[model samples]
Target chain A: MQGSQFRLEHGKKVRLANMDPNETGSLHDREEAEPNIERLKERLEALQNMLYAEKKQSVLFVIQGMDCSGKDGVVKRALGGLHPQGFQVHSFRTPTEEEEAHDFLWRAHRIVPAKGMIGAFIRSYYEDVLITRTHKWISEAEVKKRLKHINRFEKLLESSGVKIVKIFLHISKDFQLAKLRNRLTDETKRWKFDKNDLVERESWSAYEEAYEDVFKQCSTESAPWYVVPANHRWYRDLAVLQIAVDALESMRLAYPASDPELDQLLEQLQE
Target chain B: MQGSQFRLEHGKKVRLANMDPNETGSLHDREEAEPNIERLKERLEALQNMLYAEKKQSVLFVIQGMDCSGKDGVVKRALGGLHPQGFQVHSFRTPTEEEEAHDFLWRAHRIVPAKGMIGAFIRSYYEDVLITRTHKWISEAEVKKRLKHINRFEKLLESSGVKIVKIFLHISKDFQLAKLRNRLTDETKRWKFDKNDLVERESWSAYEEAYEDVFKQCSTESAPWYVVPANHRWYRDLAVLQIAVDALESMRLAYPASDPELDQLLEQLQE
Candidate 1:
């Protein structure tokens, strides 16, 4: 998923969520939910230390997907091992009157991670393209301008030493329908099912087209996007974890040495 | 800290991090820094399921303290368990021109957790009282207004079913000086020591007085402050853990029932 000019086979499915070409297993197949928890813990812990040690580079994860495509669940599981202090998650909403006065990226620009931190945007600046293009919330010309602005914004972040990882959780509309039904049937969950989600689902095709364009235009070499098949929750979690671990491992960070070395300090502290 | 009159004593050094005050032994008395990982895992797992099941009443842990007082460490330790998906941590900065244009609470209001999630505000609305008051960033009259606003804000959150747990990590200025000195001396840690921290340290007394006044006024029957003595990291972590567990234990939340009524439906799915 990393690097430039990687060829992903284009599928006929208009819906981005349903475009996964993999067809070997059912949702409940053994490989679908398999996780090596012990290995993951070691990898996550080591990388977290490296991040703390390097203390100069940052990682930003951007999550975008259809409702119930498992964006929330993926975020929860993938970064669950990291220290909360080292990470922050920001979810964007409709711009307020004040936010309207500035460029769309202003709010997000300020929230970008500082050196050595990890920041995640649940639904981010990409909304300017997805929501705007689908709803005609802004001008078509403005949308094009935003696509350019996003590429530049991400490049700027990379230049400033922030590693950007973007994930688009892809799930079938049938899965979404099931989740929506579950939300409606489960009294405890009914509050989470916003009426707008239903309204948005009706415009699924429009959103799919918007998102497809968004990926093509905004997936820069500095910050690439991974389209993860998310009809199965476990698979979605595993894919996100793999991406995070991969990025951190590539950095090869290690715990900082103590003055006179950690051996001496550990002995002293122990005494 | 519970009940009508708010009768937790005014002095004699209290640590909110101590989950059970009557359980003896100061945190510094411990010989090792090892967490009771087994107990933590169990409790965390249970808390996770509770959060997943209730999925309505969100939790907000708000941290306020002097620089080097261990707010970040406390936050890290308390939330060590639990999946990060259901959780979020937001660290506030100086408001942008856009944010400054609105009422003080506008940015914060938008970020409050939806039902069934957890959020931590590292430096929250309380800054309007602590930092702004000491720095004279806002006028004295404005500080007074903010104190009232904070009380109302917290009360509103409580009424709206957001659990607000406020922790004021209390460490003596001398302890902070030692920590700051260590940071300055260590090459790896030198970057952690900001010049502004030193500037803020100089106004320690003024900040303390401002905090004292804010605590007295805004520490209500609903969202009381927990002043944890944090000179010892082990004790600080334990104290915060206890407070978090206490907050959850008191909430009267239970796992969603897979009721007998739904049993037949669930059994059919299993078959």
Candidate 2:
């Protein structure tokens, strides 16, 4: 599948400079991709039903992206078709006073989807590494220590039946500038524009370097990072949907087996 | 609305014996109710959208019922039509070792829905008062103390922009027996039957009385308990839907006003 091309291999050095932010593999236009996007959505919904029925495993999608990289848009357009009862989306922001008291992972750990559920964290504990390191809020030694903690945390969740799919929506510096200008000019999108984004843009290269380090340190065999080219919103949505559907399909999910005394029970119930 | 009749008035003495579990007010049959249920579901979806857009207040539906009283069924049939993105359902079972280490309300308080969300707790902190009391696990004075704490906790949630709607799914002893038997005989439902339910059935009256005490103590003007007659699954689903819709409507939810610079922004975007 086109999604496999984006999956970063573990223990390999990642150079964000080498990865194109506008790559749309195989597909040439939005019209051609629309039908496939719809099909994948239907498959995702069906797979979610089986996951809920099986009640044995769960899935977590950790979505990371720069501002205006379409994190919210991908969720609304791609995986929004799943049963709301089984699918949940949580957008992480600045930690609350209570959250600040505990270790960084405490808040995320509490809300990790239970068995038979699918959860998405718009920006996750990786924020502890990315944002904290970018702002020099934590020391270099602290970043190294937190990376080890994050790897162990993902491994713990994976062992406990959570299929983790980490997706990084990659958009170019020019693309982010265009989105920011559009946000300023479009009132409907104005609510989403943040002044800090412009300030963060100045540190674009620094942020990219930080992300590269995160990929090298945290990506694992069980939960590798998929860096999606996200300049075109249509391609970004399709790629994330394909990656999610592929992850769930690979789990070999099925409904729980029927009862042994089904005929007898049916007759008794009928009576 | 027919739902108002089921909304227990605050400070009034509640007698479960007086409330007919089989009562189907204003509707003679399921066909008569189906259309109204559909309308209510649509209204609920619209209201939920407004609530989410407003992003100021949240709604919490605390669903309490006996083992066979159809708590799960009501959620699926009635509220299931909601946009899954804004609606969340959390089913509380026995507390884990971590949950047990904290106060009873600690675990529940942490998971309450945030602003612009609707959360339903299949069973809630009320378990501390009901099961704990029925089994004499906690002293009567302790139950009284916990009841006060619960009222306070609910008020806190209300002050922080939560609309609390407590629902008690009232079912007759005979009706429960029939459902239990169906679970035993029906192959698909066999997994739902618990041996402990039979043990708890022996203490049905104690549970009922304990529930009555809870209604008297915990029911507040801000958050009243609605005793939904649950003998007929159709009526139960419809009534809960009606009550939920009414509570959200009473909040008078509205989308945030359009931006003041919308026209100018549109002009700029067009350019």
Candidate 3:
């Protein structure tokens, strides 16, 4: 599916209740989606190889999702085929002392992928506006100010060859409950369960409202946000893969033009 | 096939002439070594997953080699299976003006893998001692001084729980000629033919001597150097993969001990 179908329209009001998290378009099940998943994964890798060779534009995947929404899973399943040398994923948690000392974007700005690489931010500076606003830790005015900062920060990145693809993994509240229960019961996955997630779950509606505002204010024409369906894991992976492939394919990546002197140099080496 | 056999012995004088760049041990051809290469690549992915979950120590693979020595190729073939989120590769080229203003180790120090990640440095701070010394850009005494600085710098990193695996892709002069010719003649690879590679080829012996001194002076037991034969690309890939897997395996990685609080949380969730 084209990401534009789900992309947040600029200046349009967003209501989380209106969007269906379980919708999978024309596709039905994991089995049916498997072929396209494999094809897109291969295409993603081929495009990444060209991006690495071209060394001109970089791609950033900003993925944000609530508890048990499969943020990390989508990256591993959809984008994992990428060569490690040219791809990096960054997960922002509670800021370190040094990071907290600076503006919210400082930590992220320092490690934005250099030209020729792809970087994924599992949860990024968006958290500053999300959790802070949802928890009432920061005043609503402060949230507005930060959103403005975010739009500007993204524009700055876009102007300089960073193609930002912001993604919000949309999952129903019931789906989250199932995922959380499974994590708690599975012996191997119990380590991943946190009581704090339960506390965060209480603020789900607040989080949704905050995200809607972000989509309306921060999702610009140059750097739009995709609200991907995450209730169905298979569909989620395929959609994210298509979004990633489309993002790179639009960059028009190519290997550097062969140097004119190479012919003369080739003759010298032959001798 | 053990890395120890090729490891530079600390506190011993080194001679590049004695080691065989074309050595493949018992392996005869690419087909014969394919099984081990596949096995090791799979093993590497498993180990890296543990390292990411364990989130304690980081691994740094410092790769150094002459022109056409396959530094980039080795990472693509041997370590490419890694999850890009936890793996990063850095290729140090001519230092930027800002990087040159700081100490040689400054740039490398800032980007060492955070705990739980793996990083590969294509060319690193060692270049300060190498290219500068070989071309007489700096005095011999200055090179000696930089070598001392590098040893201490590595020790500092080792103490901070960074497992360092230094590798030298040892390929012969003749082998490089063949690789360079291939690049020049291949339309797709012609962009990789750097004229400076020809310039650096003239100082091959000087470069070897500089590297030998580095191996003798900087190869600490905590972070020893492996001189892997690279004339055969298949053997090179397998050996590097084995070294990488062994490094992570030795770290005793494990999932965070299931938090005792998680059991109570699980009980509460079930209610």
Candidate 4:
């Protein structure tokens, strides 16, 4: 339940999120953590080629985090070099009137990648279960049903050979409050600081509790959740990259074998 | 009206589409005809930096083309470098029940780029005029009204500083027929050779006429239409890239200067 227990055993030091709502983690460590830039960049380039050629084993990355917890920055940095053709990032917002009418998972279902693709879901279906629970938008029984639906939905995705790597960008309430205040003062970001975000901020403890219960109910071995410390941007970015790279490596994808024509194409490009 | 007249006096190429839809230009002559791969790569990296910094200009690119004319491939190739955070690609399909109820431009409008981003529309509002005209899904009068609305829509976008680039991937019907046959014969491609496409191929001349009328009606100086020669994939890719690069370059975006401390942060990355 504590931060210490959340440590990942992958030689890569990946960590799942803490299940305990009260456990405090030292997000400061991310400030001092250095990125293996050269190594990581080379690996990403290789992954892009492998991804393009293998064209199987779709990846769905779910990024869940507190507001201003560096989720967007981490996502942008982590997948920077991947080919757009082989990958997509779907950012989920408040469901439209149309989407709200369907099952909460309907919109999220359509964005899952086809075979041989990598998809990142920002503020994903979990929002339905988490935010709806926090706001008491649905009954407790309905919330439990949705959570069960989520688990089954993920199980279906895993059965279809889609690898799901979920990460919760963990930050302290103090840091979030500071960010909200900064948004109010910053000219460029002021427009983005919605009144609802402040209202959502006020229910921080409630949201956290909702998240904890959802994690316990839905985090299975098939689709694990990684909790990345987000107070320090550097560490959070590195942690995300490490987790994603680890997941892809586990897939054991390789560059498609070069045909004679493939060699000819490379030669022509060189020419 | 001939291919010989498809030359640019200034940087702006004359809209030869209206004169002779058949006289497709040679892709080899386009500015990006032979994409200097190395330079393209450097340009893409710089583009990413600008996109992150500006985060201000959301661009929407609309691509319209005939069947087997390579809209999908061109989209996949041209946007290969752009970060998804700063760009999104939405391919419009046949209108659903809700989409059918709105104005022809409504669904397309709903998906336009937010300020300071890029959206690529594969088939867009123009469909109301083009496909509806070709298929007779609506009366000719409705098509005309939709065309006028689209012109106004693009004009409004331009006035609001959205660089509207409309591309029609011009291909000979003979080429399409040949590709169709190849698709029918090849197992890998046979899946893509839909019966609907076969029926549409029978009405090739009708579709061409519809496209010609569309060009005549909506081709304005503010949102001009370019007809790219798409018989050759390399040529089509280069032409599309030329249009995209031209649009982005004209924006004259500067790297958002973050606080001086940003440089210090980069210094830490180096260390």
Candidate 5:
């Protein structure tokens, strides 16, 4: 229930300066949170099974964060327990020419989860507003127009029974520098280091401002955005798991109504 | 080591009558196999990380079997340990209208894993030979022609740094019957029982004959088909996990060569 505190209020003027990326409410360390994390993971897996059986609704976790914010880690640790057959993860990176030729949402719209499945999008369509705005790729008027279109597109998906949970894995500037340093020094992790990440790190403040603007404009009641403190890896995974279980539980998922015909089929199968 | 026994020799005539679905090598029970399965899973994870780091080669596992042969279950239990970001599973069901218009390999070619990723096709192009031949959907000559094309297509993938490990989950007819009965009788599992599966059960022998023909024709040295005994779920998972780990290990996965520049970047960050 404490995960609800991170939900940015709809239409509120949001600011990243107010959040503590190291905040792990009431939990001291990974040891304390391990049991609860396991419990919530089981709950999530069970709820996902019911959702798959019902075939009525789907859940999408929209994960957005800077390079070291652990967007990929959260998905692997939290949502990975769902039956892989019914779970999918799509990471949105630099768009291709074909994707750019279409509208901004074209690439994302193509990969939306069907009913009875859970999907996690890493670095999702929000990058259009966050990265594009920070880089000044589109005009201010166009950015505002695109944000409006995004709100409407999400609303359309909500109407069609897609429950969206948007999360921003908030990590501090100091933490990112440490991560980059660690990546460079660790022989095994050196492969993950991209020099472009250093280039983007220069626009840190601008990216924050851009993301704050997005939070204010598009965080709706149906699909609210949660800014999670992600510096503490264990707490971040636990919080995301809680948030996922809460979202699926709220859907009131149930198996489809039992059919008497199945009983007849069972009798025949026995024979 | 025992998993190799299941590998049907390339171009050799394969017959279901010569094998037992309940074979578990020397292991007697699930408890005995659990530790080996766990070890293979960890080996698979480590090898996968190396493969992702190398980013030079990809591995594809082509899974095929009868309807109740546990194709979906094998994917979840055996290969699900993989990092979700680098692992993709695409189940090939009935093709779309456009897919039917194109060559049989088109739908499959599009989804093959790029460098440093692993892909599993639950039912693959071999279905063109097996099901199409069994149902008389294609002429006998056409089936043979398609099998030849499949051989060439797989060879092309192999030559281009793709390691293919094809698996057949060989469950017995009585085993499938028990599974069907369980699906109908179990309230929670009733959703999985399709009426058409029972309809297809009538052509069980035809499907077996078709699969044997495919094994004899398309199972080549570079991508030999493994006819795994899948009656015992525990043994099935263990065998598949061993096959996957062995395939990845055989690739000689290694991290990319270290760059001299990253250490310089690390010092600059320290400043």
Candidate 6:
């Protein structure tokens, strides 16, 4: 029941090899968690409605994972039942020509959800650290510099009433290989399979080590990264939904107080 | 019933003096227009829901007007009924130090409504053409240069699946003076009064001329400017609501087609 146990503590060294991606705390089977997930979805929708009415703060869910780690699936299944008007999903891909002209954070900063809104970033600014470091595109010194910039950016956003929830979908290498095979064999999902994924798979341990560094460096008290056990899709969805609902509930959101003058104005309009 | 007359044709010369701010076109009384406004609001909400579900084109309402010409009121009364989750209001005041460092359109470009969202800018980038030119802050050549930039910026947004609706809330000089007087006398509204408003009042004719040039130079077939008569608040709201509903309806938005595998997935979840 304590979701915070999954949060990577700030300043602590992370060993991804030691963490179990298949662990489902306190749940023996998917059947036991199914009804609870349904209940959490309803709670999320209600909380999202109040957040929109309150119009004071926003929540940002940053979902990052390797290929076939179910980042997109989690968003579609765990969060899809909420009102589309309040919830927006932004998938960050290769930077465009115009986007490259600015600093790395510029594009991400511009689209952070405004007050009374919920936004999810499927593979977010973290890519600059993960892919670039994994490919040796940036020096270790440069990676360190970018990590500081990211921390500062998150602090800036938090100061402006945005609650940042960083979730890393943790999947075993075998799970990813299986998912990739399914994508290749399934007609409906073949479009999702990319040959480049194989190239990245060769550096799986490097990516995991890089993510461990991200956990150790970027996790903060205000915006901590949660490592969700994502080998099981049902457990992944349920755990992520629970974490999201808990984050918003911690904000203590409520509708703005009604003005007495508006009541008088309503009477005039009716008359 | 015809709203097309309010749309300024691209490349046409606009004379603000010739356009009547008091005209309600074919409607003689507020009672006659009240029902139509209600109907349009309902239509707008329905269309907006589908637009959000479709997640394709975005809408930007650029509202510009003289002081006390009901820009804020129009957004509240005309658009207030729409879901706050999908509707966002951004009031552009003086540029910040960081904003001033970039091109004039940089801040605005960063915040244009994303797909399936509606964004309203109370005073938009057009302020560069209107206020700066009226006060002689920039040279005539510079004004011409910025106008060209504004047009290109808007064209960029339009090409990216954004439907831009430029509205000028047209109010007469006498109406403005009366509103200023009321702001001074009304205790609840006194906070809204600015001494600079009176100083800007001296340049009313200059602002009109500047806005006329903006209409002539920046208006395009894709995103035309509409001058809404604003002496009558009810009529102004009705006209704006009608124009917005028509603009969205023209987009012909629909929910994204359901996936064929969704039914099977739903059954799996239920089991």
Residue pairs that clash (backbone atoms under 3 angstroms), model 3 = none
* TM-score for the A chain of candidate 4: 0.83
Query: Which candidate achieves the best DockQ against the true structure?
Result: 5
Candidate 5 per-residue lDDT over residues A1-271, each given as its tens digit: 4668889888898888888999999899999999999999888888988999998899989999999899878878877677777888888988999998999999999898889988889998889888888999889998999999999999989988999999999999999999999989887789999999999999999999998889898888889999999999998999899888888989998877777888898888787
Candidate 5 Cα misplacement greater than 4 A, ranges = none
Query: What is the DockQ score, from 0 to 1, of model 1?
Result: 0.20
Residue A38 lDDT, candidate 5, scale 0-100? 93
Q: Model 6 over residues A132-155: C-alpha lDDT tens digits?
A: 999999999999999999999999
Tell me the number of clashing residue pairs for each predicted model. 5, 1, 0, 8, 0, 0
Looking at model 3 chain A, report the run of 10 residues with the lowest lDDT sum: A185-194
Question: Over the stretch A1-271, how does candidate 2's per-residue lDDT look in tens digits?
Answer: 5668889988788988888988888888899899999999889887987888788999999999999998877887787777666788888999999999999999999989988999999999999999889999999999999999999999999999999999999999888878877876654456555667877888888888889999998888889999999998889989998999899998998767766655465465456
- The Cα RMSD across the true interface for model 6 is 11.4
C-alpha-based local distance difference test score of model 5: 0.89
Predicted candidate 3 versus true structure: per-residue lDDT over A130-247, tens digit per residue: 9999998899999989999999998888888999999999999989988998987776466667788989999989999999999999888878989999999999999999888888
Q: Which ten residues in a row have the lowest lDDT in candidate 2 chain A?
A: A261-270
Worst 10 residues of 1 chain A by lDDT: A1-10
Worst 10 residues of 3 chain B by lDDT: B186-195
Model 6 score (lDDT): 0.85
lDDT of 4 by residue, A1-271 (tens): 1222443332232223343322334443433444454466567656655664577678998988878776666766767656555567877887999998998889989889888788888899999888888989998999889988998999899888798888888888777877766655554554445556656888888877887776677767767767666776666666666777777788888654434443343343334
**lDDT over C-alpha atoms for residue B209 of model 5:** 87
Give the alpha carbon lDDT tens digit for every residue of B32-92 in model 5: 9999999998889889889989989999999998888999889888887888888888889
> TM-scores for all candidates?
0.65, 0.74, 0.92, 0.61, 0.97, 0.55
Q: List residue ranges in candidate 1 displaced over 4 A.
A: A1-38, A136-142, A251-271, B1-7, B10-73, B82-221, B225-242, B248-271
- Angstrom error of the Cα, residue B145, model 6: value is 25
Q: Regarding TM-score, does 3 or 4 come out ahead?
A: 3
